[model samples]
Target: MEFQELINSPGLWLASSVMVIAVVIQAFVFLRAALAEARKVGMSRERYIGGLRSAVITAIGPSFSPVIVLLSLIAVIGAPTAWMRLNDIGAARTELAMVSLSSALVHGEVGTASFGVEAFTYALWGMALNNMGWILVSLFCVHRMSKIVERLYAKYNPAWIRLLMSGTIIGLFAYLLSGQITSPMLHGQYGKLCAGFVSAVTMLIITRLLAKYQRMQELALGLAMLAGMLTAQATFG
Candidate 1:
């Protein structure tokens, strides 16, 4: 079967549905637990209901952050797989990275014509395995997290702990971004270089210049991505 055909096949969709279903069920379970806890805390039904409504409203803007990238994922992978992965991990980029790494096992470049069923299968396994690592780590390590945090705070200054957390987030994105920009630089892909630079600048402008606008801040990442993609297309095409 053709790569696209196999990816969108009934069997693939059925397989993907299992994960999506699990995520939905998990969400309901968590919601139930939270509501129960809210009652235990003596939160009135009216207040909790109001809070839920406010939260739902607040979530709308941030929820759109993934949509542009989600469409890209849907285009490269099939809708079912993309939906499953997004629901499972809630991070489009991470899932795409896993797919790219996995597809490379079959000498396939993601979204390229060279990709086939073998590459697709490899990607499936890669994403599953990647998620398994998180599950296993949580199963073993999560219970110890509180003690670990207590020990860290006991040993290190609280200010330094905060700095460490902030630095860790910054370092994660830096690593992901370096992988992207490094390949383009080495391959003389100036269009990609332009895209990255433009995106970075756009992000800074939105975050710094338009800092007063809360909605714009929420949309910053998506706006930057659109700006970058458009710039690259215009410059390269």
Candidate 2:
């Protein structure tokens, strides 16, 4: 297939667009709600106010690089009902190569050779798939943690506060899992399993710490900002 044909593929564009849109919308809605509600909850007024601006820039920075190619791959992957025999292998190789090339470019790793593009491609796609798998699993950790917080808010907290807090944490977790830290974990088979385990523990710890806050919105935003900052440092540092 011609390169242009590859570029013009709608499935690729759709998948990429969805991922980008989801992450963007998720970040904005979460931060905004967190900011507005922070004052109600008694979060350090300064940090709560400043965090939204800081997060918008740094949190979404990483997605700009990979979302394009990632979307294209999603288009080509198509529906599982369209899966084939050797054609599947060929398609998979193409995706793997794209992901590998993208990853190498993003990290300045040595480029994959054209001669073994097929195998390298397979490895790369496998890695991407693995990373996504871990993310989904890690998100479960976030969800369960949010539910606990939800119960706490419903029982002892205000409705607006619960909405703001739950919304922000859920949103941040979704974005963070999609960000760069997930890249390495997504590639390795065992990496996601370890990540999921760690995330579960971490979420529990965060939940406990967050429990101290009577004002859920401010705390949620503050924590989201903190997570976003740490992730940026980890990814680009």
Q: For residues 70-167, write the lDDT of model 1, one tens digit per residue.
A: 89988888888988898886378889999999999889888788777788889889999999988898889988997897788889999998898799
The TM-score obtained by model 1 is 0.62
Best model number under lDDT: 1
Clashes of each: 0, 10
Which sections of candidate 1 miss by over 4 Å? 147-237
Best by TM-score: 1
Q: How accurate is candidate 1 locally (lDDT)?
A: 0.84
Lowest lDDT block of 10, candidate 2: 80-89
lDDT of 2 by residue, 76-190 (tens): 4322212221122234445545445555544433232331334333534554565566578767788898797778777775877767778999999878765634777567544
* TM-score, cand. 2: 0.35
